[model samples]
Target chain A: MQHRLCFAPLNGLILLVSACVLALPMPASAQDKVLRWHDNLDRAAQASRESGKPLFVVFRCVR
Target chain B: MNGVDLARFEFDYDTTWQAFFLDANLNVYSRYGGRDEKSADGRHSVASLQHTMNEVLVAHERRRRPESRSDADLQPAPRSKTTPEDIPLLKAGHQGCVHCHQIAEYRALQSFHDGKFSRDSIFGFPLPDNVGINFDLAHGHRVDAVVPESPAAKGGLAPGDVVTRVDDVPVRSEQDFRWALHRVVEKRSVVVTALRAAGSKPSQPVSIKLDFHADWRKTDLGWRKSLRSVPLPLGFLGYALGREERRTAKLPDGRLAIKVVSLRGGGLAGNLGLEKGDLIVSLAGRSDERTLDDFKSDLLRRYAPGDKVRLTVLRDGKSLELTGPFPPWDTTDTSVP
Candidate 1:
């Protein structure tokens, strides 16, 4: 009975640690740092106008 | 790409990736990406991109200044918006999404059929390395090395000098420099303005005149996706024989020796009875040392559609001659996919 009692608290502590770890936010990856790319050139241009920032338009042919 | 203004978004259509740094009013500040025959992204790097972005930001900030407001180039010029749908050839046949390469291909085809195609148009966006100036990958505009006895060296472009402008075009990046080179129509000499930085003093702009050779714009076209639209088809896939293979075939050193691997159906070679495994020893009696791509380019340069072509082949140690008219530049297929 004493041995069971001793192991029960240890198991609970392990579960608590795992839960804490899971609750922690994920670190941002290198890809996450990339600026949001807009497919619509007009919309992007509009954003550029509103923000007074220069537009960086990229054309990439996937095939 | 359908409704986008192609005139404002002009770039090398042969490239898979290209970028333009412009303002909201569509005043282009610079460009970022370019490629050679080596590879698509070989000339680009993250550092170079970062450098271009920083330079664009600086230029944007300068334009925003009160004194710079009067700069004519900073003002957006009025242009009639032309889209991919505006192109008659594309409008007639293509539907749905239109690729960048298709734009180049259809336009070139239109030019070809209209009897206005220039051979120089095939070699678009020639690299600065062609002029003997190798830009530092990280700095984009700074010359890292100059080829010995190249035009850049002859023109007094030294390493560490930052290119400011090419002719009248303000060069802010390597792609910008290439754009300047691409715009050279008949001028054999180009004036390159660069800023030479000396120790603890302001940079001074130095002008260098680059005298180009007749073939300065020529580059390897094998890597281009738009090369297919040129209408010159070899009708057979050839593999260049290695040094040992050439020796085994009893071919002379430093000469053309390619093994025909496969023949295209209804192709000129197939029509002329060119079989697989036939070793091509010479083309038009010219046994020059040339790669398969080089040989293809040679054909494009020397012959047009329906031109006569002659090839000498070896089969089982027996020499055979094949001659036929080159295939007509077909316009039936306009789709890039």
Candidate 2:
């Protein structure tokens, strides 16, 4: 069964402020296995230039 | 410590996750993320992400033809002020990759300081539920659920209803819903047309009358992503105390309180004499009886930068009130914390 996350009660201010201290930006490759991801945007841009494939960028927090 | 990609694609910053599909030329084909305060993954699904990827590939293929590119497609995105390296704390000693929250705060603070923080910049991407409709993106952006007693439900929306249009725009993806919701600000009504399917029967046409309160757009402006060119609000950092903690503090029931947890050095709050460990009970005459979320929305949506705001705080078991000049939202001021 897929567990759907509920965000109804969380405060945006709390979440954003908390991320500064509680969360760190980590490479998606370290956690997600579905797609081989790029941690750096410039590197991804460079790779896109070479392969002509579109950039699948996920700007996220690893909290 | 360096600022990178802060001005890249337009993103919904309040959302915990934002996925974008773009070409090598920086052309944004589409986006695949939507979030509200309730769920970190609001409206986001693996199926939708994969669907967007496929659409992006097709858009790329079409762009190969010279005629496919239009003036709208060629426009360059605006740039943001002050990169990560320019931030004093990061430049001083803060190591590791810069977090999104840090970037969000810094950017908003810069915009706030620059005096450009406005309704649109502060409250950019509103959630779908602001109108009481949740989209099931996996099933062609169908109406997954409607909040009971919400504008959607009041207008006659039910589960399994497929949203076909919001206002006059066609709704094919979550982004389309965002585009529709974007035009609704303050107090305004929007026409939503959907297809309702009852059991195994053929779907019937349904129209939902959706209107939002003046503060609806204000719902979570603090989390909305600021565009590269837009300004921001006050740069102080604080968190709402949990219910249990509020009870432990010996406060009256149902009073909304925010505890000052951290402050950026030279941040507006610190500069204005607000300190860490201070318990904020009220701002601009609003007290703890209101939810922190509502209080924040009221402050941001109603007040402008430079507006003098009276603050009430609880410190060392003493109740105190203080009034000060709000920070100047000057984005060009690089001296910000």
Give me the displacement of residue B154 in model 2, in angstroms.
Answer: 8.8
Structural similarity to truth (TM-score) of each candidate: 0.77, 0.55
Best by DockQ: 2
lDDT of every model, 2 decimals: 0.73, 0.59
Q: Give residue B165's lDDT in candidate 2 (0 to 100).
A: 72
Tens digits of per-residue lDDT for model 1, A1-63: 111112211211110000101223434345324334454666767877787788766665543
Model 1, which residues run further than 4 Å from truth?
A: A1-34, B70-80, B233-278, B282-294, B301-312, B319-337
Worst lDDT run of 10 residues, candidate 2 chain B, spans B224-233
Looking only at chain B, model 2 earns a TM-score of 0.56
What is the Å distance of residue A23 in model 2 from its true position?
A: 12
lDDT of 2 by residue, B174-211 (tens): 76567557655544888888887766888888877886
Instruction: Kindly give the stretch of ten consecutive residues in candidate 2 chain A with the minimal lDDT sum.
Output: A9-18
